[model samples]
Target: MNAAQLRAAARARAQRWLRDRGYLVERLTPDELRYMTSWSDAPIPAGQPVPQRDDPRLVALRRRYDELDWPVTAHSRWSDRSFVDFARFRGDSLYIWHYRESPRVSALKYFMFLRYVEERDHKGWLDALGEDGAFGCWTFEFPGRRPVSRDLLDSVNELTFLDRHLQLSGWDGLRALDIGAGYGRLAHRAAQALPGLRDWCCADAVAESTYLCEHYLQYRGVVPPARVVELPDVPSLAPGAFDLAVNAHVFSECPREAVRWWAEQLARLGVNWLFVVPNEADGFFTHEADGSRRDYREVLEQGGYRLVVDEPAFADPAVRELLRVHDRHCLFERDRP
Candidate 1:
C-alpha cells in the first residue's frame, strides 16, 4: 500500500485504540495532568510524514505512535489512577533525588503487580543510583519490584545482566551503542546510572527518534555521554569499536529485512554483545500485518550472533515467578570467526 493508504489504516487503528481506551475523552485538572502533556520533546502529530519509512507497515505504525501522541493530554487517556501513580512515583523520585526515602518507595514493589507484562514492570521506584547526586530513578523490572518508570526499569534490567553476568561495568568506559533507541532513555539511564560511563551512541532507524534523541539527551544533560548517531552515519563509524549494543521496545515489530539490516549492521560495526527485549511470548520473532512470522533467531544466527542470556523479563526469581503474564528477554553475542 501507498503512504495515503497506510496513513488511513493507521488512523483507523489509532482512533479505535484511543477511543476504546477512552483517551481524549475528558478534561483534567492541572495537578491531575502535571506530567501528562508537559514533555518538551513530544513527537509531531499524525498525518505528517514520519522520518521516511522503507516499510509500509513501519510507516503505518510510526504514524500510529504519533497518533498515540504522548505527553498525554488531559483529554487523552490520562486516567485518575495513572495520575495518582505518576504523582506518587514523581514524589518518591524527587525524595530519592534528595537521598531521602518515602514510604511510597516501599509501596512501589506492589503497585500494578498484575500488569508485569511487556517491558514495563509492575511497580514504583525504589533503587537509588550508585552514581553520586544522581539520586533515585524508577528502573529495573527484572529481579523485579523497583520504584521506577517502565523505561528506566527496562534499562537497569538490561544493564544488570551486563554488570552481574557479563562482567561489564561502567558503560562510560566501554564502547557502547544503542540501536532503535527512542528519546535517549537508555542514554539517560547510562549517564545517570553509570556516572563513569564515558562514550555512548544513540542510533535509530527512525528519523524522528534520531532527531528527538539528539535534543532529548542534551535536554536531559546527558549529551556528551550519549551522542545520537543518525542512520546515515552508522556506516561511517569505525567497525569493531563497540563492546555492547542495545535494542529495546519495538524491535520485534520489525520485518525480516529490517532484522537482517540490524544484524548485518551490528556485525559490520563489530559490536560484541547484542542486547534485546523482543517482547515475543516464547522466542524472538516478529509477526507481520498479514500474520507471517520472522524469527529473528534465524537472522541473528546467520549474522554469526548467538543467544547467550535468556530469561524472564525480571531478574528476580519472585518477580518472574509471580508474573501474571510471561515475557522473555534474550542477549546475543556476535561471534564471527
Candidate 2:
C-alpha cells in the first residue's frame, strides 16, 4: 500500500481502539492535536495516599458522625459510609487543592490569581498568611509571589470578596459563622485577615468535617478566634451573636431539607448578613448526591433572608471565561427587623 493508504489504515485502527473504549473519536486539526497531547502529557502531582479506615482518629470521628441524626439531604454527599475519604481532607478529599496542580489547570489558576490580585490588591495580605503545604496539600510557586495552594487562593479571594461587600475589614468585633466549614479553611484565613473578628464559629453537619475543622484551626494556631461548632451545638449559639455568616460551595451540595434547616438556624441566630458561594452561576440550586437539583433560594427567602448581591466569582468576564469558573458570590440580608 502507498503512504497515504497506510496512514488512513493507521487512523482507522486508532479510531476503532477509541470506539471500543467508549470514547467517540473525532478528527483533530493540528492545533487541536497539540492541545490534546499537551493535556495528556500534563504532570499530575502525587497526593497523600488515603489513610487506613481503622486509624483511631478516623474511627472516632466516623463513630461520632454516625451517631448524629442528620437530615436526609445533609448526609447525602457527606456521610461516613459514602464519604470515607475524609482522611485526605487537606489534600484532595474534601476541599480540592491537589487536582489543580497540572500544567493547564495550574496556569488557569495562576491567571485567576492574577485577576484576583489586580481586582483586590490583597496579594501581600494573602502572602502573609503563608502556605506551608501542611497535611499533604499541593503548592505552586508563582513569579514574584510566595508559594500558594488552592486553599490560600480561594480563602483569600472569598475573604476579600466578603470584605468588599460587608466591610469586614472595618467591622470592629465582627463575629462570623461558617456553614459547612470544611476543615476550617476560611475560618483560619478569616481569623488571620480580620484581627477585629471577635469570634469565628466553624459549623458542619458532617462529623468528620467538625473533627477536621477543630484540628485544622488549632493546627493553624487560630483557635482563640476560631472554634468548631458541631451541628448539634449550633442550636445553642446565642441569637444575634454573629454579624455575618458565610457558606462557600456548600448549599449547592446540600439537599433541600438540609438547606432549609440551615436557613432556619441562621435566622434563629439572627445573623444579619449571609455570604454564599454557590456552585451554580446563574441560579440558586441544591445539588443532591443522587444527581438531582432543587431550587433553594425560596427556602432562604422564606426564612427571611433577601438576596442583595449576586455577582460572578471573578469580576472580570475575560478572567471568568478563561478560567472557566462560573461560581458566584451571593450576599443576602435579613428582611425582618
Candidate 3:
C-alpha cells in the first residue's frame, strides 16, 4: 500500500482499538476534556480562565521545589517523591513549573545525575540540543563531567546507549513503539537520528499527554512515521510489529494491572525487542503507582519475554563494576510465541 494508505489504516486501526479498550474518544476532544490534570484524572479541557504565570499556586509549587534540599531523595523511594513521580504527574501545570521551567537545585541535580552523570559519552551527544538553558535546562559546570536536562539527556542517552544492542541498520521501513513516552523527547531525537524509520509510535496513558505529544511530535517534525498513539490503542497498532518497544524508566511506576497489561500487549504484538530502564538499582522490585510492590520480571515472563542483555545505563565496564548496586538499563527479547 502507498504511504497515505498505510497512515490511514494505522489511524483507523488505532482509533478502533482504543474504542474497544473502552477509552472515551469524545472526552479527548479539545472542547470536552481540555488539559490533563492528575494521574487518576481523565483528559479535560482547560478552564476558561487559565492561570497566569504569577498565579499563587504556581508560585507555591515553585517555592516548594526551590526550598528542597533535593527534589528526590538518594534513597530513591517513591514516598520520597523521585523523578518517577515528576515524569508521570498528571497535569500540564505540574510539569511546566516543576520541570520545564523551574531551575531549583533540587530539580537540576535530580534530573542531572540519574542519566547523564555516569553516562560519560552523553556530553558529545548533547551537542544536538544546543545551549543548555535554551531547552529549559539550567547548566552547572561540573569538573570532567556535566549533566543537563534530565528528560532530554536521558532520552538521547537511552537511544545511543542501547544502540549497541539494537544494531539499527537503516531507518527505512523501521518501526518503533515507546510506551509511557513522556512528551516524545526520544521521539524527537529518534526522528533526527533514525532517518529511514517508517513508523514510530509514541503511546502514553495520560490524556493531557496525548494532546501534548501530538503537538510536540509535529512541532519537532516527527510526524509521518512518528505519531502519538493513545495509550489504550496499544494492542492494535503494532505498525509492522514494532522493531523495538521501549519502556524507559516507566514500567516500575505502573500499577500491577498496568505493568502486566503492557507486558501482554508487547508480547501480543510480537515485537522483536524490548528495552527496560528504571529509576532504581539492579533488583527486580518496584513499588508501583497502585501502591503494590512487584518484581517486573514476573510481568515479563508472563508476557513471554526473556532477558537477553543486562548492563548499566552507563557503558564503562569499570564504572559498571564500581557501581555494583545499581541495575539501570536492560534488554528483553520476545520469546517467539
The candidate scoring highest on lDDT is 2
Judge candidate 3 at residue 146 and give its lDDT.
Answer: 48
Candidate 3 structure quality by residue, lDDT tens digits, 219-337:
55669778987544555674356888887766666555566777767877888788888656665655554465678787787888888887776565554454342447788887764
Model 1 agreement with the true structure over 54-88: per-residue lDDT tens digits: 44544454464445422211111112122222112
TM-score sort, best first:
2, 3, 1
Quantify how close model 1 is to the true structure by its C-alpha RMSD in Å: 15.4
Please list the residue runs of candidate 3 whose C-alpha ends up more than 4 Å from where it truly belongs after superposition. 1-124, 129-135, 139-148, 169-171, 315-327
Cα TM-score per model: 0.59, 0.80, 0.60
- Candidate 2 overall Cα lDDT vs. reference? 0.76
Model 2 has a clash total of: 0
Question: What is the lDDT of every predicted structure here?
Answer: 0.56, 0.76, 0.57
Clash list (residue pairs), candidate 2: none
Q: lDDT order of candidates, best first?
A: 2, 3, 1
Top TM-score hit: 2
